[model samples]
Target chain A: MTEKLNVFAVRTLTQKEYFAPGHRACQGCAEALAVRLVAKALGRNVIIASATGCMEVVSSPIPFTAWRVPWFHVAFENAAAVASGIESGLKVLMRKGRLPRKKIVTIALAGDGGTADIGLQALSGALERGHDFIYICTDNEAYMNTGIQRSSSTPFGASTTTSPAGKVKMGQITWKKNMPAIAAAHNIPYVATACPSYPIDLVEKVKKAASIEGPAYLHILSVCPTGWRSAPELSIKLGRLAVETGIFPLYEVEHGKYHLSIDFPRLRPIKEYIRLQGRFRHLTEEMIGQIEERVRKEYAELKEKAAKGVAR
Target chain B: MGKRVGMEVSIAAAEAVKQANVDVISAYPITPQTHVVEHLSELVANGELDAEFFCVESEHSALSVCVGSEATGARSFTCTSSQGLALMSEITYIASALRLPIVMIIANRALSAPISIWNDHSDVMSIRDCGWIQFFAENGQDVYDHVFIAYRLAEDRNVLLPAIINMDGFTLSHVIEPIEFIEQEKIDRFLPPYQPVHRLHPDRPVSMGGIALPPIFTETKKAHEVALQGSMPKILETWKAFGDMTGRYYQPVETYKAEDAETIMVIMGSFGETASAAVDLMREEGRSVGLAKIRLWRPFPFEAFKQATLHAKQLVVIDRAISIGGPGGPVASEVKAALYGEPIRPVVYNFVAGLGGRDVSPSDFIKMVDKAEIEIEEGNREGYEIYGVRE
Candidate 1:
């Protein structure tokens, strides 16, 4: 089933900036774009806990930081854990009449490797504890900060520094871990997947996640031109392709009920998304067929689950 | 004065945090340390204390969250034991390096391979160089008093460093003792509000825990070192203020009957009480023995240590943990280093004892001192001995 693309109701973003300029991110960085939009949605009444990744490294370089909002840079594997403390800390302050504001949003920003691999246990723990915070995983497929190493979030058939297409091996041999599904299994109030290509969709998901009472996890598919071996200017285009080709579906799960946000009834071929990226150029026809088959099967499963209505 | 009541040392530690008006307590449950957090959780739940009690999943997250909350300008506390403290070792350095004033209570337990959940100094000694100002508590009163003392020293703007209060596991944590609970009003006047100079506020943003390149890494380390070393004055000043308020004095290096004694026994943690008892027995027997207890381990109190031991001819240093194939015990090694350049110092002898929950009584301490005195008189001072070990 498909829903109408309501672009008219989605208002244009405000001029105020929280993720200020002068960050050392690569040009046309999709993750940077997502962070800007995410910050805009969160507004100023928030504290951010960022794990050691591209976003953290670029935004903060000692004595000079791009973050205008209150931000903390903890270790790589404990962004969610840190956010839990921030939320609880603020709650205690408010209850004790120490803080003037009764409430403040607590958010965590982590990279693919931080969310899917090193930080998975912390993420799981925060969600299970039902802390009032939003955990955003800006998935750039691989560890873009550490020279394009393969992470669990790296999709199958994508070549990375650790998962190179050598003489015997083609590329990455395993499928990308379903991080959103793992988050949903925590039974948190909200879990969603978004793309930075559609700024309004991404911002809307973030705002919705922030409004939820308990923990909300938002997984954003951020494109990495340098890691993906694509043109830097084509970052937005690649992000759109990831969604349009059914490679990274745009959907939200509320109270364990799945709802598609951007449903492309007639999906574009995966080749359109893979051909431009040099990381996937080493793929053979047989391997492409296998990937395609796997994508279709997963998409079918998602549709069936979404159509099943609210989980009981 | 609030009240004088007999309370479990762990519960007294929790009450001390309550008196400090801590804003957040993020802890993972571990044996011996569990009772402290349990009482804290009860206080938060019962509305007796208005604070956040986070049942963090692991010790790593417990300390990680404390770092997060403390950076946000909140008074935070946490507690852990052997494996829990070991699990939190990585973030322990981060908490200090970032200069987050989060106070933690470590109910000391032995690190395992034999897997014993008993009282020992191994856990505290394992992370000796983590850069936190560590204190050893001899009893329930010290545990209660130092909780307030640690927060005051840690939260000082000049010394924005994390602190650890170590109490012997099962021995002090499980033992009930009569303690004077200070009034909250007095604590408020003494501690004042923790006004964070640099905090994570959206209105006034400041970046913490930033990456320091090699060019500035050395400077950052120097700053941290200077800050730690410079904290000694503030530590003494804080103890003076606390002592004035409560009439219970504390010092970096405390002594008992050591003014004219030829031989002095040095110890830490709960064993300090036992060592003092042994010193009294030795004095009764006219053996000219005394006791010196190290309360402040970090900022190592080198001046105080030197001053305390200069008059003694010999020192029987008791260590509950071994350095394992390197030198002697950790405390013994630090003690030797502290005394190396001194013109007049004791012929220090190390005795590793009371490990893995093994009880070291007052009689045992007396016997160890006797052995050490005999060794020194016979000019047989060589390697350190494992006191009371079944050889």
Candidate 2:
């Protein structure tokens, strides 16, 4: 399978100049990487509606612009809604013979704060409408854009501003919100979870999403070195470890079937995952054991769902 | 296209959108604005109009879909009222800033709390500064006509903006009136299909809605404002073209029976006829009163307001919505602001009346006209009276 996949990769051509390399993304910023991959997959015919957060502030700082493709950054909460309006606006303009060029795609980009918190209603409504668009949530676990504050997407045993580690507590009390699962319940054409270390896989998933007829969601786990207090170079190693340790599983939902995209034969222990990240530095052996137990149980459930896919 | 004669207001609005030739319409049923989108959806479904209609999840998506459609450089149209319009509040600002040329119909209705679904100007007035060109219609005919004109104004090269055509909710949205429709071919001649200067297309790429820095951000906003103020000439020109094509004239401020009247009643939206009837009735009773209907609320016709109120001694400004804690009603306050230092202006009296579509009877109009005169005589012109408020 590996030999067949990368064998013809030389012939693969990408769409040109949408989100260019000049963007002000920090090194090892998973969110920016996801954006870069998505842009390549979407081609030059794409337009983006991004919420105001880390990526937007850094990339678009005034007279400077990073996008070769058309990009619109509305408020933090209404990126989805703004993307919806853009989608509708383009359709109408095309119908009236006003559109200069034929091919155009609109997408909304948001951070965990923008998507899981204030923007959830707009996100949910946009998906429910079945609009022909994609919404990508660059989940950095916490609201790193706003100073490492806690967000709903923040996972268990993680130390954030609002979920700081203390004498009586471990780290965060709650587990990460099942955003992809919730989106899956919408019964949209497509829903997937991805991380940036695997660029080609991310691109493939995005291509699959774009081919779908209606709303498709892609939740990307963006690593935040500043927020997670992890080493910059450790980002990829940490991202890979997350999947290997079963902390964050990569999966996709189609029609009604769930399929695991990245599988680990023998999962690594949870202690190895947390010891490198400063956010979970305070975790003890017992806490790691508990996290491991929860991860194993969740992985088992996901495996069962993947097993049920053929019947569906 | 030829002129259509004597049709329902809602039907006329649907006809205008059909004439506007929108490509995608996102709609959900809301009272007063329902028929407009309902009819547009039918046209799209039946191939009467070649279009895509998205029966959206909610008003939020309705506006979102409109934004997406506009950003893609497509001519999109939608109609919503009250709660629906309120729900779309966030996107309304984005639509204008993106300069998508989105045309929307806001059937004026009172927002709920008391939960009434009646005709009123409250909803439209609440979003007064939403960055879209706001227009008011006195009856169904205006709703039908202005929608076509709105598309022309919004899609203009200079004024690439969004516009809202507000007709009185139940009163104008549901009321069938003699509305003259223009032929589609005629509309095509008068208002050409939207020609966007900047399209979000791959061939000749451009960036839209970028984060404008301090150096350029102010200029971006200034561009919108300058376009808004400068759009007056084109707005008048569009109206002239429409009038020339259909023989039905329209103006920002329309005056009637005010040539030599002592008292003038200023109002907006669907209640113009109600004010007109009182003007006629009061004149017979020797009250020397007339009426002035303001059609364009934004890019407000200051010259027209100045001309229409030039001869009046007392002006009764009736507003259907209240602007609590700041001024009386926003319309009354705005009127006062417009006439702040005009040398020969009449003494203005603001009246909050006909809220949430409670009846604005001709009897009440006459009483308001009389009350304005009494307030003028008493030298009391600073405050407002909630008209028909019960003890």
Candidate 3:
């Protein structure tokens, strides 16, 4: 079950910022805001093992850091593996009486490129081993840090630097990799999808994930304004449009049971979401129709799963 | 003193890790390196070693886990052979730079294009510049003893760097040998609980492995180089204290009957023992030949190495790994570089031998020396020959 939060409830939330300000993030980077919300949920009693990506580079420069909690950044593609190690190390140390037995939540943060592509193996390994940690994948569709290169999580019709729109070819021709489905398939204790546009919901989901035992995966749809070639001011509006258009749904899967965070009797048109971003500027009406068809089918399937409820 | 027991060297290496009281052992199984992790898992399973041992997905994740755990102020360890080492080599450099002080045991094996799971120096040679404190073990006993010494040296506040103990695959790992382990009390005294210089704790809240810009990159590297080179004194001090407790002394460059010899052979890893025997055999025949075994490979004992072989006229450097089109062999290149400016230095000759688990016995070492001598007489000085290769 998910709690309904109003603007009044958001005002009551803690004003303390664990992810400090004065770091090098873009003007309207929703991923950075998502990180701040996640950090707020985790508070000071957490250790983060971050993969080399946008947030890692933006937050941690030598001798400077945005993290108020203990954080570690290893090479690309091993955030889950590193988090597994941190969890096991802390567990063993506490058990051996070398450290005080306190609840220290271990979290692994990675971008979509780090999570869906290079880091997939390490993530699967850590999930299979069932380490007590939270894995948060901030999905911005492409490798935005490397100048908008195409990633596996890049949507089928979105144009990137690597998947350039040209005379003979169009944008990314592959469907976005369903990372939440993969995480839920691991039979993990909790798997949720959130967005920074819904700040309270994102924070609540992260808090729930941190409270659960064993492994939890959170896939947050992080909107990149610079990479998407959209106006920086429309970053939150774009995220909301993505969810309302059913291109990126907000839901949670707990123990094989799915719960849709927001239900719509009628979904918004794909043009309202796609026309605002430069990445989809090259798409024709026919291509937009095709994308809309697929989005409708996928959204219907997700709704079916949520209705099935306790089927698993 | 503890009881001397005949055990498989890999198992003994695991026992040494157990005695060191490591907090985490994360490894992936590879040939010749499997038994070490297998025994460690067994120790953890049976409640003999109170450690967290995980068989991770790959060697990359294995070393990544060690780096994470070590950064968390836990004594972490992992072992791998050639392919596994190559897979994890990227993280090895990071671990040392972060100064995690994780101890690793590399079972030396040949790299694969032909894909052979056999003993050679190719694995360790590939990571020559990884910046870890690297050394070779001459035999099973040496491998067993260095585990404690590595932990002591790596965990020292003055020498907070990771270390690698290389032992010949199958030659030292699979064979049973008598190892005399130190008493538990002595080991505890020698290697105290690891006190990390920086750790990821909520109480401390430090950031590790941050990206260094160009302005600060060179300074960080300079500091790392200084830290590695500065660890030599602590390494010597640790060995001296261990020798006082166990009565078996160790050194950077160990020599065998090289004090008055004109011709000396140089080698590393398990071949040192066989080369020593070959030197003795040659000496009995009234020939002037000796052996200089290089124990320390990184922060390479330049002074001790020059002291050992500068007097000899001809130095036969036997390398187990080929450099492939660049130089003759990696070790021979280092030897040449170490002796380049010396006024009294040997005319170094190199031979690549014992490749892909091929047997190079005492006679084989003697034959290599004989070949080097004849080639020197024939004025063939610059190039190296892959010994035992068919035309």
The weakest ten consecutive residues by lDDT in model 1 chain A span A1-10
True contacts kept of each: 0.69, 0.68, 0.75
Error of 1 at B229 (Å): 1.3
Per-residue alpha-carbon lDDT of candidate 3 for residues B1-391, written as tens digits (9 for 90 to 100): 7899999999999999999999999999999899999999999999999999999999999999999898888899999999999999999999999888999999999999899999999999999999999989999999999999999999999989999999999999999999997889988988888878778999989888888989999999999999999999998998899899999999999999999989999999999888988998999999999999999998899999999999998999999999999779898999999999988778889999999999999999999889899888899876598999877
Stretches of candidate 1 above 4 Å error?
A1-11
Residue lDDT tens for model 3, A163-276: 999887789999999999999999998999999999878988988898899999999999999899998899999999999999999999999899999988999998999989
Better of 2 and 3 by lDDT: 3
Best by DockQ: 3
DockQ, cand. 1: 0.69
Residue lDDT tens for model 2, B29-116? 8887888887887888788997767776678768777776676667788899999988888778878877878889988888888887
- What shift in Å separates residue B130 of candidate 1 from its native position after superposition? 1.9
Against the reference, the lDDT scores of all candidates come to: 0.89, 0.81, 0.93
Considering only N, C-alpha and C atoms within 3 Å, which residue pairs clash in candidate 3? Answer: none
Q: DockQ for each of the predicted structures, in order?
A: 0.69, 0.57, 0.83
When only chain A is evaluated, what TM-score does every model earn? 0.96, 0.93, 0.97
CA-only RMSD, every prediction = 2.8, 3.0, 1.9
Candidate 1 local lDDT, B24-79, one digit each (tens): 89999889898999999999899898877889889999999898888877899999
